[model samples]
Target: MNWDDMRVFLATARAESLTAARGTLRLDPATIARRITRLEEAAGAALFLKSPQGYRLTEAGLRLLAHAEEAETALSRGIGALSGSAEQLGGTIRIGAPDGCATYLLPQVCARIAEAHPDLDLQILALPRIVNLSRREADLAITVSRPKTDRLHGERLSDYKLSLAASRAFLAAHGVPKSVSDLKDMRMIGYIPDMIFDAELDYLSALGVTRVPLASTSVSVQLQMARAGGGLAVVHDFALPTAPELTRVLPGDVALTRTFWLTTHAGPKDARLDRITGLLRDGIRDEIARLEAMPVARNP
Candidate 1:
């Protein structure tokens, strides 16, 4: 089979549906079907078994997947090698991250990278839930926990702090809690407990916070509600500078630590991605240090 047919087959195999694969391949479902049929004819095997759910790979398909992925990796390396100088390298790179990092951290980090590589295009997916790298939804993803699967490679990006916080206006009207016990009777803002995607984010539960009167799955939403004097919320320490209206409450009593992990699909190295990752790693760490160093409102 030709490389074109193999490319379509690879995307279809990963997505498991002609319609789903259409999004990434930018081809119509009919075109994808035709290409898959041509590929199967050339190989003289039924690569996929059709079912109600989607396309299920047969044993032969599974075997071909390994070679196909290796070919893709080789193509990536070839492109990286011929991509000329790092200064002139230009292509789109998509990043998936939790809203806190997406909203508060990535803009400046990406802006600097874009400034350096004027031809490069960057897109950030600010998702409340975990980003699915296996789906090829993002070229790179930032996560709270280290990935467990061997199909993905993960690296610790940085460690940042979190703390209970409230707006100055909220404390003025509702008063501050003197003890963690007192928080039981107060209004709180945080993630919807049932919707929390990661255990590392369950900061309020440890504070004996059983109820969140104002809750959301998105960190940016919780920060806005807290800024509007909604209630106490567990907020990123590095994010405090961005929300000066909100003040840290019982910083000593509620300090938390969590690490950000950079993740990518496991494959042969691509120099372009390697360089971009280095810039991102260094940029994020420096930005956090700078933001956390800025003066933030805190209670005595």
Candidate 2:
């Protein structure tokens, strides 16, 4: 009997209806029925009992089911093993990362790969939602938190420092506060409602400052608000220096921080991914050093 027929038998047997099997397989119902008929004729026994409810599997069908599942599993594993044998680092590597990570980190990584391995293909999925590596949704990932699953290989890449900042125009109009207590009277741009635990909130809360309830979910919007001289926001040091008008508030001692991580699945070795991770680490390290070295206005 054909393995194709056997696979159809398993599908039809499990689904209990040719219509359902067709839907699951995305094939026509007649095609599924034809395959079932072929399988039953080869077996010389009825595989299912038709009823008003659905097709119920016969004892013969159940017996074949065990073998069919085993065969399918073995076939899948064999295919995976075969693919893993390739030593070339040229296939598409699906990578997922947060928004800023994609914007700040990937360009440099892509440049490095282009210089070294031009044939390598990279597909990046940039979203705030973390995709599952265990489910094969992504081949590699970079996240703020290390995944707890044993199926992943997670690593802490580095920790980043954050500070509260605003445009000089905003500070001038809003009247710069000299003390942490003075923060209550000042207008402040806050994290979006859902992002109350973000760096901005943490920094304000740590200083015993009362945050203004106005919040924007988008990081880009928050930056824009600060840039428009609307209010103060907690921006990462790397981001702050890029804004010509933005200046650090309480520069000497800020409590906001976040950690960066590099993570991947435990797959066969890939030189492209290894080289990409190395570039990302170097870029982040360089940025951190640059931010730390820049002097900010001291609260005198």
Question: Who wins the lDDT comparison?
Answer: 1
Instruction: Give the poorly placed runs of model 2, Cα more than 4 Å off.
Output: 1-89, 195-214, 266-272, 290-300
The collision pairs in model 1 are none
User: Cα deviation in Å at residue 283, candidate 1?
Assistant: 0.4
lDDT of 2 by residue, 254-296 (tens): 5467887778754433444565556667766666667656766
Q: How many clashes in candidate 2? A: 0
What is the per-residue lDDT of model 1 for residues 1-300, given as tens digits with 9 covering 90 to 100?
A: 778888898888889998899998999998888888888999999999987688888999999988988888888878876663456658888999999999999999999999988988999999989998877788899999999999999999999988889998899899988988889888999999999999989988898988888999999899999999899998998888879898888877788999999998886568888888889999999999999888887874
Give the range of the ten consecutive residues with the poorest summed lDDT in model 1: 80-89
Alpha-carbon lDDT, every model: 0.88, 0.68
Candidate 2, position 203, lDDT: 53
Evaluate residue 257 in candidate 2 and report its C-alpha lDDT on the 0 to 100 scale: 70
